[model samples]
Target: MASRFTRLTTVVPQLARGYAAPAKTVKVPVTLFGLNGRYATALYSAAARQNALDAVEKDLKALDALVVKDKGVQAFLENPTINRKVKLDGINALLSKAGKPSEVTKNLFETLSENGRLDQTTKVISSFAELMSAHRNELSLVITSTKELDKATLNKIAESLQKSGLSEGKKLLVSNKVKADILGGLLVEIGDKSIDLTVSTRLAKLNKLVTDSI
Candidate 1:
């Protein structure tokens, strides 16, 4: 299933593969919804068709890593006063560190930087990754807890969730976050569905139930 999903981006001729009868056809890029998603999706589709998805993915990952490593790169990408050429060179240099970036990747970055949307680069990468994961029928879950959970606890939660029907036949990806304001317990986000077990939410519900019972 996973292998077939990864191959979703691959175009195998139906007739050649004996999967379908021969017919005239046209090619269209797969697009993601949302603005940043659209751009990222277009870039991914282009790279996939050109067989440069791996290279582009690596370049994006490297850039994303830099944004988290050196504070300067993040600030620079988001700073509008730096000028397009400067931002392009900055990203280009980073890409160089990872070896040559695909021309399509370079062009997309340049376009976004020139339009003062470089800040969206991180989101674009994230969106692209998510798009790919989704192509593989994978969904990521963000778990917000008041305190950081140890590996044992996290794996426990993941294990339990895995047994549940939250994703059915689909894949489940988990991300953990710490938020002091939650007071206690955890909140989980699985796609658009969120399960709030935080004390804050429980209290609110209890309060509502009490008031309504009054």
Candidate 2:
């Protein structure tokens, strides 16, 4: 692990080395750009190379949960006022207290801190998860409605989506989000595709059509 970390650190100074996608079709297919994307891609490649992908995924998911569940932690990651050394110390302590974090994950935290990229930690985690999902051939289904969905409603929506072949042989992961501004109806997003049936969108279309016809 130390050797691998050394290699990563040595390679990072080259700037263009770690951003390359793995030379396999089954790896993450999406082209990630920008600093967050490059960091996520590098992490994905390193985890894959070390055969610690599953452990890294679990570690990241756990940390992601902490970020979501604790506002203080989220603020700590996003806090621009915090100095790099202070933030790095806090993050190392947090990860040590949490479940076992893989060497790859720990190295990633260190790299982010060393480069003053801690503010983008949340985005990096999210992008890494996206890469993981693609590698696992998982499909994400997000339903947006005016109100929070009950379990039964969510189940029904999942069942309906499954029957409609939305999964496409990939595992289906469903989530619901509430957006009161939509007023009514559902807005469904599957991967890169979105179906917007919200009342607001329909009303806007109607208004546009009526004005155009006039």
Candidate 3:
């Protein structure tokens, strides 16, 4: 039994590396269900086995797009009164029509239905995709901005950040968020440390400068 467990562990990551899709497909990190993130790891293996990581990613992306385009769909799917059969049918129809999700994705939804966990459908799919992406060595980034950043400026930001003392020239995880409250300037957060370049902070500094001059 110990040997079998050892063997399984050895082959899991090998499969994960070979079967996972490109990292660009999933935006957020996946979180597993109760106890440990075992279910998430298993789903990653399944996708890896089928070499359907990208396809499954597309399936999840389709769902994500659907949720964004129709804000009410998530609530409707989660609503308790909705019959399981109806929900399953709706899920299948949605994925099939999208024509991008792999068989693995369909099977996952079916499993969720069997367990009466339709509410977790989106979460599970996201988690599975994230696992696959991580195994592929991709870093997910979150960016915050006061307004939409043009592509060129974004490129500059990425290039400038790569030169920062923290990055030391390594490629980084980047995402953008917009907050009007920043007033002006930019705040860059990479991992634990956040560099504040906001206008409010600048004003505080300037105020200190005047006090010091006095």
Candidate 4:
């Protein structure tokens, strides 16, 4: 286990070298924690130095979609029985088939494979995306409703959020998710904060108030 961790530590610098001449220091746009965060931070730093942040992000988004759509790819990454070398080769082949992915992106998957962390691939990609979004000054906004929202409605909500200072200067990447359990109204999530306006939540609050009174 110690050796595996050591390999993981060393791979980051080695991958960094494969990119452009190392910057004196690369600033991570956001703070992230945990193993996935560490890997994502390292990849972000390397990509930032290489000026390939967009390319690496594009590669990761494509890979993430592929994993979602391809059960075989999902199985390959999650399979613990497969040896590291075979996983490495499989990653290489998969990247090859994906058409020219950035070297930084390739290095990320290769390092993950070598360190037997392929099962964390999806999480790492998500972490990397968070970093990229931060880098681009983008904020995630999710609106939960009982039905899918039209694009115009989403845009209007985003604009309102921005005007209301909830979004402020950040660019909002808005998405809507349907949840019948919400009952009615919207559950808006802007970055880490949530404004719960759902009828279910209001009803629950009213019930709690009555219970306390009783």
RMSD of each: 8.8, 5.3, 7.9, 2.3
lDDT of 1: 0.71
Q: What TM-score fits each model?
A: 0.76, 0.79, 0.68, 0.91
Candidate 4 structure quality by residue, lDDT tens digits, 67-181: 8888898798789998877877876676666689998888787678767898898899999999998988999999999999999999998999988778858999998999999
TM-score of 4: 0.91
Candidate lDDT scores, in order, read 0.71, 0.77, 0.65, 0.84
Task: State the lDDT of candidate 3 residue by residue for 41-134, as single tens digits.
Answer: 5556666566666777788788877876886878878999999789989888777768756767766666556556677666766666557656
Find the 10 residues in a row with the least total lDDT in model 3. 1-10
TM-score of model 1 relative to the true fold?
0.76
Model 2 alpha-carbon drift over 4 Å, by segment: 1-26, 163-166
Lowest lDDT block of 10, candidate 4: 1-10
Stretches of candidate 4 off by over 4 Å are: 1-3, 6-11, 19-22
What total of clashing residue pairs does each candidate reach? 0, 0, 9, 0
The runs of at least 3 residues in candidate 3 whose Cα sits more than 4 Å from the true structure, single-residue gaps closed, are 1-38, 164-173, 191-193, 200-214
Instruction: Please provide, for model 1 over 110-208, each residue's C-alpha lDDT reduced to its tens digit, 9 standing for 90 to 100.
Output: 656645677777888888787677666777778899887888887787777778887555677878999998889899887777888899888999999
Candidate 2 lDDT over residue span 89-121, tens digit each: 887777777777887787787778767788888
Residue 207, model 4: lDDT of: 100
What does the lDDT read for residue 17 in candidate 1? 28
Cα displacement (angstroms), candidate 1, residue 29, comes to 11
Instruction: Answer with 2 or 3, whichever has the higher lDDT.
Output: 2
Candidate order (TM-score): 4, 2, 1, 3
- Give the candidate number with the greatest TM-score: 4
